[model samples]
Target: MATSTQSPLAQHWGYYLNGVEQAFNWPKTFILFYSSSTVQKSLFKSLFLNGVVFFGGLLILETFYNGPEHRILGCSYANITGFPMYIALLGINGKFFTPIAEKAFEKQAKAHPRTTPGSTNIVQSMASMIYTTIFYINCGIFAAVLRSLIPHAGPFLSFFMNCAIMAYYAFEYKWLYMGWTLEHRLTYLEEHWAYFLGFGTPITALTFFLTTLHSGAIFGILYPFYVIMATMATPKPATPYGQPLTSGKGTPTDLSAPNKVPIFFGVRKMNDLVISLAKMMGGVQVDSIVAEKQKMMKMD
Candidate 1:
């Protein structure tokens, strides 16, 4: 009957604080976080490959298709500008570092028997990937449309909006890796929007401003750092508002319960799948499931 008593700041802000600490203690945090040589090797290789691809692809495009004007990075200034790259930027993070993070997470899980199981199976990971890709693509399009609607405002508002979106995208891998459902993820984002925005603001500035100054290489390197930090933060769950996640085997101790609404009329979950199908077949009485649920609740 006891409840979590930790303050909201302590619950959700631990990793964020650790990140700030790590910024000050770069060498120590790097050594501690990447103690394993295998992980270090994998991350280095991924970063190298991604950098080559990103820079090489740009070189090819600039040389062959758009000429010098299309070059964004390693140039004096940007002559080509568009919003499509924003969506591609999200995909790049997932394409390169997600596997490495997953590997590290699996290793962590195996080494610590007490660790609660995360949702890292291929099916779940794939589903999360699909869902996130669709979500970000929609967000990118929405940002582009919004920018068009208010061109007089310049990229100021668009940058802020995109930064918030990208911030969620940054932590999303960790959230899904930790087995958070869509409802839980959305709720956490809503409740801690400011914290998340602050967490992601640096990366947003890098992607938007630094890249404009031909500093994509810097952005490329810093990208993996954020992903690594996010991976480290994944297991430590946070409450919706207050209290850090408990050190046990289950979801975070948020005050809100999972939604109980039926996806369709009279269907709450898999238990009612068959009954709902039966009603669609017209072989069972309609509203029977609801009535039965009401009776069960009354009995309880």
Candidate 2:
């Protein structure tokens, strides 16, 4: 009697979560969130803080010595199709999305007095940029050392392996339930899935190669991943580790039982949002246009 609902979304999320748990199993897939936390927490903090210094170091060199004149927000090729788009997608969040996060940080700290929340936007952004830099640098050295050790490695082979690993994780997030559906846990996994999609595109490969080999071509590629991340991100609900929003209509199993927490985005933004009749998709493109930019940037 309980088999009626939307096609894919109809199924309750409890089962969905089972899939998530299996997917994040570290040994099964080396690409995972825990790998990010392998370092001592204090050392991790120091690493990102140092990453901030490293970013500054590069910027300093560019600004004074080499001309780090390009804006992180600007693009060399401004489309979602190219290899560069991948890096822009990932990197743009630090430049553009950090503000929304910072606001949340301030509010969250005040809301939960005793609870120890994570670090600040400044730190998180530093972490992303810093870690990204580190990954690329490491990748470069590995490429160089391995080339002499195993010169048989080629672009096709490297790309194939990267794609294999990345595709597995990406699909796992889309279809599998990798964790408990508790809002906190769900939210955590959502970020892990959405951001830091490792080695997904050629630009990603380039960044890694450039960092280790000092290849300028590889260096220019990091921007698009950041851009795509900011532009294409599904405005994930603020809820953490959400499985199914418990239903509270009539039956005892109603999830609307608790004072329902608000959706991440407020009505102000979604209000009167336009949708296309054909696509059934409304709202503007994820690309940061003039209007979205002004609003997000708070610059009139």
Candidate 3:
């Protein structure tokens, strides 16, 4: 936590700096990632398949086949092959990543032993995981649209949005294991927005200038390290300092404190809209099927 003597601005920026420092604390990341056999295996598979095989193949094609016709072929190859390959890697790597995250969380739990409040039902847990995954993907898409649509400040806004999203992704595995709801995670992130922004900066900066496929490949390679860092990190929220009484009237106020930024507010709204539409469509399909069954019963 930030000291009371520091102004709110200083505390906020202090947390941001702390987050940045934590992100690049690679000695700890290396120790964690290499110490566990499971993490090692996952890193190997992710590095080989996503990094060496997929991205390496593209790099080879681009290098060897640089003609206009070859460019067209490369584009077609990426669309037809690389896209599906990436999706498959995500699914495969998800299985590997989950165990890595669980082990990391369990290791931390042994030392900290804090009670995490969340639903224990397997079905509900699965549903929440699925919902959260969709919400994240939706948030990414919305951020991209914002980047393309708005002018002047669009890129900067999108950049910060991506930073927040990346931070969320890094911490998500830990949060999920702790049984935190999506709402709780988002709220915590917003309240300590600066820290996460800084934490997410390194990853975002590394990938930001690259081409889409290149960025995706780099992100896949680096994400596990960030996940480990997030597990080890202790996020400090910005502290509010008391303001002197104005006009010597009433009580001292905390108006000087930095306000919580609702970073995920837009994404939450978007996710809700999408979920509502999906449910409505599903209900319609069910009703249609029931009506068809009723007609068959009448005929019988």
Candidate 4:
């Protein structure tokens, strides 16, 4: 496939289409889900816990509080319910999701073993996970700010930004298993922005229009399936399509890939600021942990 004589434009579009294809690859998702006991157990736990229990509770509350007499109260609660539920789910579902992600990684590794597989002690793993969760929250806030601040184009910009974020979330487990540093993962995703944008479009589209609480519910139900898909997917980055630009004097000048986009720049800066503040308050220094992990990766 790499030796193909396709034009850069054609290859770029092919990568985009590949992402869209992977997103809808439900047959593969079902196959993996049913074939692995671990995957099944984890998914069932997610469905029952997040879906049936948490979302069900929300529905019950909404049903009772949705009448006109409680309209203002209901609307206000609806707006705020999703944020708390999101935090709660992160705490509750991390264990279940980790197993699912591990199962997916194991399946993929059997087919194609990684040369530099990641290994971290429990402490490092916990620190990294906490840092990732906080970064994700910051990204969410950044997207919200973008949507509110810009008038006509803000929502659209926010939508694409979210597509990139969702793509990262789906693929993060696989990358982590492969021992990618957080910076490396974010850099790669931003560089392959076009492919991820297409990959994440389906999920973002599904949840984008719903209320925050409802969106969170739907996302909880659907996220596990996407994780499987991401594990199975082979993302064709746009780096291979770097066509050099020629000067008027016929000298080749620019050789940069066209698809490199700094989609995470704003959110990353925000996350860094938060991390710095936390450290100033004598909190865990995630950067030091990350640097240690990177050093270990290099040594290995």
Whose lDDT is higher: candidate 1's or candidate 3's? Answer: 3
RMSD values, in order shown: 12.0, 22.4, 8.0, 4.8
Greater-TM-score candidate between 2 and 3: 3
Residue range 204-242, candidate 1, lDDT tens digits: 766765443234544655665665555444323333343
Clashing pairs in 1: 8-242, 11-243, 11-244
- TM-score of candidate 3 to 2 decimals: 0.82
lDDT of 2 by residue, 203-260 (tens): 3354434432223223322322222222222223222324433344543433322112
Per-candidate TM-score against the hidden true structure: 0.53, 0.24, 0.82, 0.81
For 178-275, candidate 4 gives per-residue lDDT tens digits of 77767788878877777898899999999887877788888888888899999888888667654443334444333334777788889867866876
Candidate 4 lDDT (Cα, whole model)? 0.76
Q: Give the TM-score of candidate 2.
A: 0.24
Q: Show model 4 residue runs off by greater than 4 Å.
A: 1-10, 68-84, 114-116, 120-130, 242-257, 276-300
Name the top lDDT candidate.
4
lDDT comparison, 3 vs 4, better candidate:
4
Residue pairs of candidate 3 with colliding backbone atoms: none
Provide the lowest-lDDT 10-residue window in model 1. 258-267
Candidate 1 to truth, TM: 0.53
